[model samples]
Target: MLDILIKQVKVLDGTGNPGFIADVGVVKGKIQEVGFITRKAKLVIDGNGLCVSPGFIDPHAHDEGCPFFDEAVLNKLSQGVTTDISGNCGQSLAPVSERYWKENQSVHALINPPECMHEFTSFGKFLDAVEKKKIGVNMGFLVGHAALRIAVMGLENREPSLAELEQMKVYLRESLEQGALGLSAGLLYPPGSIAKQDEFVELCKVIKEKNAIFTIHIRDEGDYVIESVKEAIEIAKRSGAFVNISHHKAIGKKNWGKVNTTLKMIEEANQDGLNVGFDQYPYNANCTYLNTILPPSYLVREREQLVMNLRESQFRERVKEDILACREKWDNFVVNVGFAGMLVIKADKTPDAVGKTVSEYANALQKDPFDTALDLLVDNHLDVIAVYFSMSDDDVETVMKNPYGMVGTDGIYMKNKEKTHPRVSASFPRVLGRYVREKKVLQLEEAIRKMTSLPAQRLHLKNKGLIKEDFDADLVVFNANTIMDNADFIVDSYAPNTGIRYVIVAGEVALKDNLYTHAASGQVIRRKEF
Candidate 1:
């Protein structure tokens, strides 16, 4: 007898194919059968008028520490995401050297608070902790370049010494052996920003040797975006590792349609036999550290020193000058999008600044916008979250239409009443409702394919992307007609999406009737040798 059975559901199958009426049977933790199944089971779901497809796979996620702290991973499970590829954007919580742990604590705090920092000292230990925690969503991770660098070099701006480089390679190889899917670099952030292309090529050699992938949040997303894409392609070509671009976009008004050129470049690279693709969240705005508006020159300093610099009149003017000058040295968010486009979503110390744009907050305080932003950073100990409205609708659609494009939430989780970008909760549903159903930008099957099979295939998760016999029984049952994202920029950022009827992970009903079942059926998806 089957453990669970769904009757008369329209199975989309996760391929770019039209849905068909069928019954699916699940036994143990795998799909037992698909077709006209007359299996008897303990729990049977009448999937009439519901569309069942392979559970969504988030190709780029930042929920590495969610399993340890919140095992349910409600934000992901509620959106029908059964699997998350965490450790994206060069941030993972593991493999910390005891010596550098204190200095690197601030970085890890972005994922987990200080109290939880001692839980994992190595990549293997982190994975083990997640496994023991028994999360509600399957998770795979890429070893972060920043974590590796900090472990060995402690936020040094200079290139690694030969011995230090070897040590990083050792950590990366050990991480792969212990189950990391690949290496991810956030070149836009430091210490990743400090490293050069040569350094990445060397690290990717280790990735290639292990048959793993290399994913990157490139060095720039505005003005220099084309150059950044070229740099990623160069890394892929030189290292022979599969490269996936994280949250690909052309930010700023002037760079609105640059994706046309960048996509063509990626396609040409693929045609030349280089392995490359990109993932994008279905939103125009992006969320990140408020200080990213400042140039990288300002970011390399320690938090206290940075705050000191922000408080200094001379240094503050220089920083503001650099931002307003639109220097090509880094992606200048302030100059590209202007103060009006930078919205403060989270600032614990400056509660009044929350829900206000930098410009608005500055006006209320009767101060300059740059000073208001700098003061917020100083008051908040250099920890603040802001949303930048910087991408074009046409560019977003263009990337989505590409055959190589896949979906990722790039979602940042917030605690208590802290606000986050709506993409964290509304990405997948928004894509289905607004783009696929309402705007007719893509068919349901194609959109589902991008969300499911494409990402799984890219990450080489052989058993999880498709609805086939003997595959992992991770599934989602949703009302296509009623599905829509309710979360928005200002009013509601954490509101759960609508029409996600059921979410099954590892053959267990983790979410039923639009409510999380709190089932801890998820497992760690470690890397397997090709």
Candidate 2:
């Protein structure tokens, strides 16, 4: 008898292989059989002719901020995600310190900020805590450059001294040695904005020495997108770093077709024997703090100085002038598309502001959209999250079809039904439902591979991406015909998908019929360092 037997399912082995009917046996937390199985089991689940594939791996997730806040990561589990790669866009959860608490108060408080941010001091300690806590899904991480930079030096906008740079390298090397799979840089974010190309190459050198990957939120996704791509590729080439671009997108209407040029550049880089890839969520919109729209120069000062500048009329006039004089040449998305592109999804102190666009709020207040945005940021102390309806469906699909492209939420793990981007709950299933099933943009097998093996390979997880006999029994069984995402804008963003029948983490059932079993069976996925 087996621990569990899932019988008569169409198995998509997650290798981009055609689906075939098979029975799978699970025992002692790993797949014991993958073909013909006649033995009885302690528990048997008739798959009801559903499709079983390896559990999806989300390559970009911000849930690492405080995994426990997600309450079993129900949103992700319902969508078939079993492993999440966090520590993205220059923000990670570990190597915590008081300065991190101060610098990130607004960002942290916005998402159910964890009370224990200061407890964990190193990557290893953080992973240990995660294991002890027993989170709901597997986790992998990249030590973020922004966090490390702050840890070593305050959020100053200047080149690191030779000693300071070496200290940063030491911290990164320690993180990689202690199970971090890679290094990530949010070059567009403050503190990260100070990183010059020479600095990136130097950091990538440390990452390359450990044979780990380097993932970057490139400096610009709008006007300077092409140049940013060239710089990212250059860092990879010069440092011998295996790099992945995070949440790839072209953010403005004018830049709608730029991904074509970016993809070609990445392809040619691969041809030159360099490893490069990108991940994208299937939404035409993006979510980030409202302060991100401000010039990085304005944020380079101390926190007190930043607050003073926001209140000063002269500074406001300067910002207003820049906003109006904006050419598409700047990285500020507000200037690129104007304030109308920003839609407030969550504003805790001002709950009434949720579900409204900046333009709408501005019009209601009879103020310029720029001033309304600035006032809100000042009132909230820069703690606001919004969605940018900046990308085109055509551009999103074009990037999605690329062979090197994998899926990532670039989304937060929301615990509420508050107006959040639907990608939070529906990204993977949306791909299956809207893109794969309805639109036929990609075959079912191909889409599964992108969500599974492609991300596993990128993270260097040898055992987690496929449904082989000896692999861990992390799997999802769902109805192909009925399977589709039900989440949408605002209220329905919390709605679960329609077809996920069962989710298995380590051979035990975690979700049966889209309801979480509250099983803390997840493990911290660490790098296999030599």
RMSD of each: 1.2, 1.8
In model 1, which residue pairs have backbone atoms overlapping below 3 Å? none
lDDT of 2 by residue, 1-530 (tens): 79999889999999998999989999998998988899999989897579999999998887775466554777678889998888888777666566554565333444454666676568788777677665788888888887678777767678999898898888789888889888888887777877888887888999888888888999889888999888889998999999899899888888889999999999999999998999999999888878877776666776566767889889998877765666323367786666787889877776667788899888888988887888888877777888888888998899989999998888776555567788877899999988999998899999999999998887888788899988989999999888888887766677878999999998888998888888878888888875
lDDT of each: 0.89, 0.83
Error of 2 at 166 (Å): 0.7
Can you give the lDDT of residue 395 in candidate 2?
A: 89
Worst 10 residues of 2 by lDDT: 104-113
For model 1, residues 1-530, the per-residue Cα lDDT tens digits are 99989999999999998899999999998999998987689999999999999999998888887876688888888899999888888888877888887766687567663355555577898888788886889989888998899999998789999999999999999999899989999987889889999999999999888888899999999999999999999999999999999999999999899999999999999999999999999999998999898888678888788888788999888887878887646678887898899999988999999999999999999999888988999999988989999999998898989999998899987765258898887899999999999988889999999999998888889798999999999999999998999988789888878999899999999998668777889889999888
Which candidate number would show the highest lDDT if scored against the true structure?
1
Model 2 bad stretches (over 4 Å): 97-101, 104-113, 327-330, 415-417
Query: Who wins the TM-score comparison?
Result: 1
